[model samples]
Target: MHKEITIFNETILPGESKTIHMQIAKLHTMTDLQIPIIVERSKLDGPTVLFSAGLHGDEINGTEIVRQLIVQKINKPKRGTIICMPIINIFGFVNQTREFPDGRDLNRVFPGSKTGSLASRFAHYILQEIIPHVDYAIDFHAGGAQRFNAPQIRIVPNNQELKKLSDVFGAPFTLYSNHISGSFRTSCDHMGTKMLLFEGGKSLDMNQKVTDEAIEGSKRFLKHLKMLATKHQSMEAHATIYITKSDWIRANFSGMFHGLKAIGTFVKKGELLATISDPFGKIEHKVKAPHDGYLINVNDAPIVYQGDAIFHISKELE
Candidate 1:
């Protein structure tokens, strides 16, 4: 049971482990910057799982999770291989932005063309060079700046195999999201691969709880896939909810916002979600939930404009 794995366009024979840097672009002074990737291939044949993060560039928590996983020589895969791409958008990462410098989102340019934009080229390379070699994948993400998300695993409902893998990841919540066009999940699905999207924490902010959960979840996923034989304590079983639709609660008046609820809090229709007050404290307005659901995301900052998103609700089951 032997297999060959490639890292940063370089191939490694079976039972080999290596690190390679994938060149992304050059700096203003022509300094070549590359994204580091690690590949670990075992002698025995098993499922190949790819762990990718930093797709949004500012989502540092996911990037750190991949870093820690690769640095530590913990329980190695007894059968399959693990391919890790810690930073997928190096350009945006340097600028602490969610999108590439070309003003394009790398995540939204999946299965892209080689002669397209910068984001499209990177997406195309990933789809052709890496995705085809993996059996399963985990794309990590966090809420952008000013937004906070409860740790959860989002999977396509119809993909039962991926849904089962999501359960084993053991996130506090499991969200059933449909496949969106041009998303990594959509591209991978087209190639007959299963990928799970794990969302948690806030951009550029390190949350220990989210990091711990992600690390534990990744290990659990390996065990469930029969890639790791080591056993550990299991995470608490949480209610897995399916959200058919979700929408944002926007502010109707421009003012300073005072959030009354936090991420992971359940809210009812017409519930007070926040309060908007003028700078002089003379005018105040109450923001309420439009429907009953869980508060998956909420604006963390106190300042907002009249159409700024204040909260995001995903309908929950009774």
Candidate 2:
């Protein structure tokens, strides 16, 4: 039997479910905002998993994935516990921006201080109040600045456990990534919680394909932990490409950009990937693949500036 769990001064027993509204800081108008933390516990004892999204408010695709899990009753684990935080940065979500009203990226500040900024305090609360009971976590994210990423799972290289979990989750692409300083993944690593970062689509947009991929991968992940309910069947996972090295292709000249290649397609060296032309139609520049590799990310922006990263191509694969 699992012991009772406490969050926000509320106790949840085995087989019990609850939604806790956590209040941090208020808006300038003295209006209070609540971040909902939804918890579901099974009667049997097992690992505790957390599914979180919306670290960046504008990354609504992540939010949609988590919300669908609840709507689909996937959050009710067969055993152990499942905690969902569909929107982590409510402040950013309200304004439909990536950063907080104070202009701080919530993902960059981790295990924060109690006396710090609003974002920092929320960070501190999560690390202190919520993460201690979490045995595993999957944080969803989307590409920023109009860059569309293929569905992928990211983990720091060299961890066999995480690698195995990634294989079980079975995203279309698994990329080896180093932990960023003060990131939630890094903080979770410090707290001894294994975590997987799911990246797909682009900010301020929703793609059914991306969300479906995420939802299916998440079910696979839960089933691997033996937490998925019997009614929900995990789909057969496709072969995943493991990327160890990648580099971004930048725009050579500022112009109206057009992409010819699709995301997630393999490109041969010197293959024409896109073209950039001035609005005046006087000159056009061709964007070609530098080497033979898969295109993992492509900029969806109509305009590009010189040195703007427009494509992310794999340099090495495992």
Candidate 3:
């Protein structure tokens, strides 16, 4: 027999999925909202998987990916559930900004308080109402609008269970990063829930390659966990490099940029990465890598200023 679970004032039902818009605050004639959501759950009982995106509203690729996943008519899980919340910060999404209307970063205010700030209250609600019920979670993201990241999974290296899940996600790259305080991942880890962060592309834009990778990787995750039937022909493995540490290459002087390298390229120390030139085409400044690593992210546009970040290099550990 299958049992359905409902949450948040019965607005979300397990067997049926829909968007639950919760009013967070009202500004005279305007009202701010947060979207509490639940996707259709499988009829059988098994592990529950949560897919969330748009914690930073402008990072929209993940939102689209989750939307596509929920609509996909795959064979029902033999024993499990899938809950997807494609957009969490409706305020930010409406404004096309990364932070909330209160200027708080929703991603940084996790496991929040019941009577705290708006962000904190939302966090508290998610922690109390949702996190307790999930066996695992996948939080999707992309680089901010001004930057682009190569498709990758971010997981903690020491956590063997999470590492296995990251590998099973099957992205082209993985980053072993420690959880920071007040982050959703850290809060989930404290609650003993393993969460994987999927990052790619740029904010507010859809890259077909990134979208395809996310869809394929998520299906692979479902198969690995036995939440979906495994297809023999859909088992091709992709190469993934593990990097334990990554750093940004910043502009040394203010000028227009002429990039010579692309994202996902391996670079050695002292490699010419870009050239900075003045408006008159005089006094060209050469930008080079300070160390050897893979360029997993780089600024795509040519215009830049002093101290602007141009490249993100990840040094492989395993």
TM-score of 2: 0.99
Identify the candidate with maximal lDDT: 2
**Once superposed on the true structure, which residue ranges of model 1 sit more than 4 Å away at CA?**
7-9, 229-237, 316-318
**Top TM-score hit:** 2
lDDT of 3 by residue, 188-278 (tens): 9899878999999999888888988888888888888778754322455586789988898899888888989987888899999999999
Task: Give the Cα lDDT of each candidate.
Answer: 0.82, 0.94, 0.80
Question: Relative to the unseen true structure, what is the Cα RMSD of model 1?
Answer: 2.0
Off by over 4 Å in 3: 1-4, 11-19, 26-36, 74-78, 229-235
lDDT of 3 at 22: 56
* lDDT per residue (tens digit) for residues 114-158 in model 1: 899989988998888888888888899998878888888888767
For each candidate, C-alpha RMSD in Å? 2.0, 0.8, 2.5
TM match of model 3 to true structure: 0.91
lDDT of 1: 0.82
State in Å the error of residue 19, model 3. 4.7
Worst 10 residues of 1 by lDDT: 230-239
Give the better candidate number (1 or 2) by TM-score: 2
Best-to-worst ranking by TM-score: 2, 1, 3
User: Model 2 residue 224 lDDT?
Assistant: 91
